[model samples]
Target: MKTLTEHDIRSSFVNCSKGEAKRLPLPKQLADIDHWDALDFLGWFDLSAPDRSYLVAERGDEVIGVTLRSPSAKRGFLRRSMCSLCLTSHPGSGVSLMSARKAGRAGREGNSVGLYICADLDCSLYVRGKKQPAPGGRMEESLTVEQQIERTRGHLDAFLERLFV
Candidate 1:
């Protein structure tokens, strides 16, 4: 994957208004993100960063397709008894926090860190009850939701590692 600039990302968006894309605050680390490894991004914008700042990504410029990530946080969503990715009922303590970014600068290098954790599971889709596709036929019989989540986590970890070293 090829890293993208704020301008590149904004231009790729098919649905959002140019004004909105331009106005959206670029992550101060915008130059720091590994835009290439990112999947079909819907959209991206900076999240306030002192303790933890994030860059939200979506399949389009619209809010409908989105994912939020914070390099500083290393934590995703909220803590829960179950795994949103796998839907496994862990003891609310088995979850993990993952973070990935470009290596040297946001886009200059590729490095990411992920921790097996028990943190808040606050993502809108996961919280509200939506399932993303796993590698198998379905989340039910094909592969456990936990496996799916792990798979994504692995992908993220690898991407991060690629960025890091």
Candidate 2:
């Protein structure tokens, strides 16, 4: 991910309204984020508030952001579940189902799309072997690690694009 200024982040959203973007809280440590290039996507979730999550994904030279809402946080499930974007599994609390309303009129009418994802949205790190894949994920892809990273980003970007279309 490229280093984004406040304006870039607030203006890049494809699925949220301008007012919503303006009001959304930014990471308090924004100036201290030293490694923007190492990030595949920039995201954050509010643990205290639980229902809100935000993401800014890099698509070529452009950035696209979306605001997501989780139905509710289920604190205690015994089973491990896989994140659709990272293809990694974790204890129930490590992943969540987040829904983002569609862009423009569809969103105004309350239409949204949802998917299970890593609670922290660090798929870029997971796919690159920087972070571990879900507990049981196998190195089954014949592609090199670099290729896998690119593929994962492609899948993630495609999902984000759907919110706009």
Candidate 3:
């Protein structure tokens, strides 16, 4: 991943209207992101609308974006959930089911694709050890860090592919 501008991010959205895209809030401090190269995609939950989230990634030569929604339901504190992308386990509500509206006709028909993901949208950082989940939340894995990164990206790519199907 490379550093991206607000224009680049705003124009990459595939599932929302231009007006909506223009109005959608972007992550703060876009120019200050120090981990761009470590990211497979940029994802953030909207502060004003807690249920809303966004993700952007580069696929081949194109940058693609998607709007995601998460339910507001609470989870049991003793339960742990794993992100499907990075396979990192988080306690309680640390994992969320983020659903993105499908692109094209399916989206217009209210179709969406959902995946259990890190609630903070920090899968890249978690996998790279730049961030940590709760104590005892991380599982020991035989896969190397590089392998885990590749696996995470592969999972994200597959999820994005579902948007076009």
lDDT of each: 0.38, 0.79, 0.92
Write model 3 residue lDDT over 103-130, tens digit each, in one string.
Answer: 9999999999999999999999999999
TM per candidate: 0.31, 0.88, 0.97
Which 10-residue window in model 2 sums to the lowest lDDT? 132-141
Q: Give per-residue CA lDDT, model 2, range 76-157, as digits (tens).
A: 7677877788677777677788899998898888898888888878777777767775556435678887777677777788
What's the number of clashes in each of the models? Answer: 31, 0, 0
**Cα lDDT for residue 91, candidate 1:** 39
Q: Give the TM-score of candidate 3.
A: 0.97
Instruction: Give model 1's TM-score versus the native structure.
Output: 0.31
Question: C-alpha displacement of 77 in model 2, angstroms?
Answer: 4.1
Question: Which candidate should be chosen as best, given TM-score against the real structure?
Answer: 3
| Higher-scoring candidate on lDDT, 2 or 3 | 3
* Cα distance off (Å), candidate 1, residue 159: 21
